[model samples]
Target: MDNSLRALGDRLRQLRARHGLTQEEFAQIAGIGYKFYQDIEGGRKKEIWLSTVERLAAAYGLRAWQLLMPNMPEGSKVARKVASSRVHRR
Candidate 1:
């Protein structure tokens, strides 16, 4: 499995745990099938669709970019660079 995919799955699991939700509960909240959500959190769904990312982000009241780039510390150089790049894209 790709490192990035594994990291994404790990972050997803952490977020669910932080919210004290089970996979089934999270899946329901995200409007996705339980098995499909499980595949994603298990890192079996290698190529996640943008719609799925948006759904998951919405379920957690987060931005899609935040979900895609998990664990970024606030005020960090890398985070600043990403934020600046996003602003420039607009």
Candidate 2:
């Protein structure tokens, strides 16, 4: 798995916890199955869907870039790379 993906998933777990959301609650909000969310948070980033990422960002009150880039600034170099990757993937 990509290190960027690993970091993103880790940050997502922390963000979910900070919002007082359980895996069940987060899964509901993200519109993904509970087991799917569990798989992601359990350190396996193999099944994420972009639409679901959008849902998660909305639930956290953060933009997709924020969730994807974690500690990076919105328009910083790292954010640009992540955004670029996302853009090109489609």
Candidate 3:
């Protein structure tokens, strides 16, 4: 698996635990299939779709970029770059 995907899985697992939710519960909340959610958390799914990212973010009450780049602070260089690119696309 890619290192980035592994990190994302780790972060997602941490978030799920922090929220006191089981994988099944998290999957249900995210409106994703339980087995697919497990694959993501286990880093078996390397390439996540943008819609899935959005879903995960909504499930955690976070922005899509937050899930894409875990631990990135708001107003940081990377965040600004992503935001600007998103704006340019619109």
In Å, residue 4's CA in model 1 sits off its true spot by: 2.1
TM-score of each: 0.74, 0.67, 0.74
Pick by lDDT: 2 or 3, better one: 3
Candidate 1 ranges beyond 4 A from true positions = 72-90
Q: Score candidate 3 by lDDT.
A: 0.68
Q: Write the per-residue lDDT of candidate 1 for residues 54-80, one digit (tens) a residue.
A: 667667776778877857423211111
Name model 3 segments beyond 4 Å from true.
70-90
TM-score for predicted model 2 compared with the true structure: 0.67
Q: For each candidate in the order shown, give its overall lDDT on alpha carbons.
A: 0.67, 0.61, 0.68
Alpha-carbon shift of residue 21 in model 1 (angstroms) = 0.3
- Tens digit per residue, CA lDDT, model 3, 1-90: 999878878877878777688887777777777788899899998687777776776677677788677573243111111111221121
Best by lDDT: 3
Candidate 2 accuracy as lDDT: 0.61
By TM-score, how accurate is candidate 1? 0.74
lDDT (Cα, tens digit) per residue for candidate 2, span 1-90: 767667767877777666677887776665556776777777675656676576656666667777787474232111111121232121
